[model samples]
Target: MPRYLISFEKGAMDHIPEEDFPEVGKTSHAVIQEAKDAGVFLFGGGLRYDDGDVEHAVVGTDGVVTDGPYPESKELIGGVMIVDVPTREAALEWAAKIAVACRCAQDIRKFMYDPDLIE
Candidate 1:
């Protein structure tokens, strides 16, 4: 099975939350259960909506500490799910379900398994 990451895109909440965000709590649990039954879900979670406040960058060596998201981007990671599926199609199906459930656009990406190259 291949691992895929499903992330919610930024600023998509407006469209889905106009009425209400039914995707939280109760509905999320149902989705988790469904994934579990299908044997593809490893773990999934939501991220707290926070501004870049309380964020800092530090360089460390030899057990020194660092505090930051490393190479920063305009958008931070919002939420994620780790899914193990037999194919990209299966992962996309799961990501679609998560998108509807989370009421946000989901970015589906596969984890690289090859060890020969470095990013």
Candidate 2:
């Protein structure tokens, strides 16, 4: 099976009013549940947005870990879901559903397979 990543940018849905968050949450959860029932969902969750815990680290070739988000990326992943489906179109369909439910744009990506990891 091929796995696809459905993701949205951090703050992408910030324009959504605080009062409407509950509804958005409910709608998104319903879609997630639907995906699970269809046996396409693998895993999904939102990232922590607090600056304190959102520390970045870089691992040097010398085996030393350093602070900072490497090249200093301004964009962060707000939320992501992994789905194992049969085709790219199916994944896109899932992303579309999530986008509508969450009231935000969603991106679809295929996971790079590592043969060593499988065997």
Candidate 3:
């Protein structure tokens, strides 16, 4: 089995009206619950911003810590879901369901295999 990351970038849902957030949340949670019931969900959550500001920090090779994300970043991950599935097609199917629920497109990537990480 491989773990796939399904994520959407920040501002991806900006076009959605604020009043519709509750409905969006409801639908998205339903998808998550479905994944959970299927035993494919590992972890998932939406990032939180403080007063419309993202709270982040970057660390340098010299062990220096800088406030905020990388200066060159144009997009930030708004939400993410990790699922352990047997195939890429299964991951794609889940991502499609998530996209409809969130009303935003999702990016999917397979995690590299690591023997030590495998249970």
Q: Pick the candidate with the highest TM-score.
A: 3
Q: Looking at candidate 1, what is the lDDT of residue 86?
A: 88
By summed lDDT, the worst window of 10 consecutive residues in model 2 runs over 49-58
Worst ten in a row by lDDT for model 1: 16-25
For residues 1-119, write the lDDT of model 3, one tens digit per residue: 99999999988988999999999999999999999999999999998865676477778899998877779755788899999999999999999999999999999999999999979
1-119, model 1: which lDDT tens digit per residue?
67889887545565665456654656767877999999888888876656755454556677765666556545666678888888999999888887777777788889998656422
The candidate that achieves the highest lDDT relative to the unseen native structure: 3
Q: lDDT scores for all predictions?
A: 0.74, 0.90, 0.94
Clashing residue pairs in candidate 1 are none
* Residue-wise C-alpha lDDT for candidate 2, range 27-100, written one tens digit per residue: 99999999999999999998875767635667889999887666866677899999999899999999999999
Which scores greater on lDDT, model 1 or model 3?
Answer: 3
**In model 1, which regions exceed 4 Å deviation?**
14-19, 50-74, 114-119
Q: Is 2 or 3 the stronger prediction by lDDT?
A: 3
For candidate 3, the 10 contiguous residues with the lowest summed lDDT are 49-58
CA error at residue 8 for candidate 3, angstroms: 0.5
